[model samples]
Target: MTKTNNIEKAYDFGASEFNRKMKRITQERLKRGLPVSLDIPNDATPEELEELKAFDAWTRDGQPVED
Candidate 1:
């Protein structure tokens, strides 16, 4: 029997890809400074896109901290 299943491989691939894309976005945003526009990819899943938008909004809001 194989050690890794297709589903596991697919999930890992998706997660790694998401992280890689996020890293690229982070670098670009850092260069351009905060309050950056939504830079999500066209092929991003709906959930990913939503998360990106929410994160962008949070950053634009100055990422408030709870005291």
Candidate 2:
């Protein structure tokens, strides 16, 4: 499987963990809107890229992709 596929599967397998992390992120964002967006590092892995892509696509519809 591709790295993106694997990461997507792992995300499904770890749904609870994902929810917890997102909840924390949302609460933090609500409490303190950032003045500047943080940049992702240059050497990020394929999986990291896929995660960000999935977040962007999914958050709008409140849906998770099927693994």
Candidate 3:
């Protein structure tokens, strides 16, 4: 008998699509001058912060994060 790791399987299927949707929503909020709240932990890394800053700049300039 084999056991399935449902959570891992779900993540594998949806992670990329979920990230894309979230990025789009974030950019739209930035364009509208609305707050963008993330679930980042307090111990987030510097790289994460830098990426977020870059995304903010791109969205402010009417650019999408993925492009």
- TM-score: which candidate is best? 3
Q: Order of all candidates by TM-score, from best down to worst?
A: 3, 1, 2
Give the top-scoring candidate (lDDT): 3
User: Against the hidden true structure, what lDDT does model 1 obtain?
Assistant: 0.48
| Model 2, runs deviating above 4 Å | 1-39, 62-67
Give the per-residue lDDT digits (tens) of candidate 3, residues 1-67.
Answer: 1114542211221135665666688778877889977556688787666555554444345544453
Of 2 and 3, the candidate ranking higher by lDDT: 3
For model 2, how does the per-residue alpha-carbon lDDT over 1-67 read when each residue is reduced to its tens digit? Answer: 1244345343442255664456455445545864323346699887777666555333333333332
Worst lDDT run of 10 residues, candidate 2, spans 58-67
Select the stronger candidate by TM-score from 1 and 3: 3
C-alpha lDDT of all candidate models, in order: 0.48, 0.48, 0.53
Judge candidate 3 against the unseen true structure and give its global Cα lDDT, from 0 to 1: 0.53
Model 3 residue 58 lDDT?
A: 40
C-alpha RMSD in Å of predicted model 2 compared with the true structure: 6.8
- Candidate 1: pairs in clash: none
Writing each residue's lDDT as its tens digit, candidate 1 over 20-58 gives 455455556766875445567879996676566555543
Off by over 4 Å in 1: 1-35, 63-67
State candidate 2's TM-score. Answer: 0.35
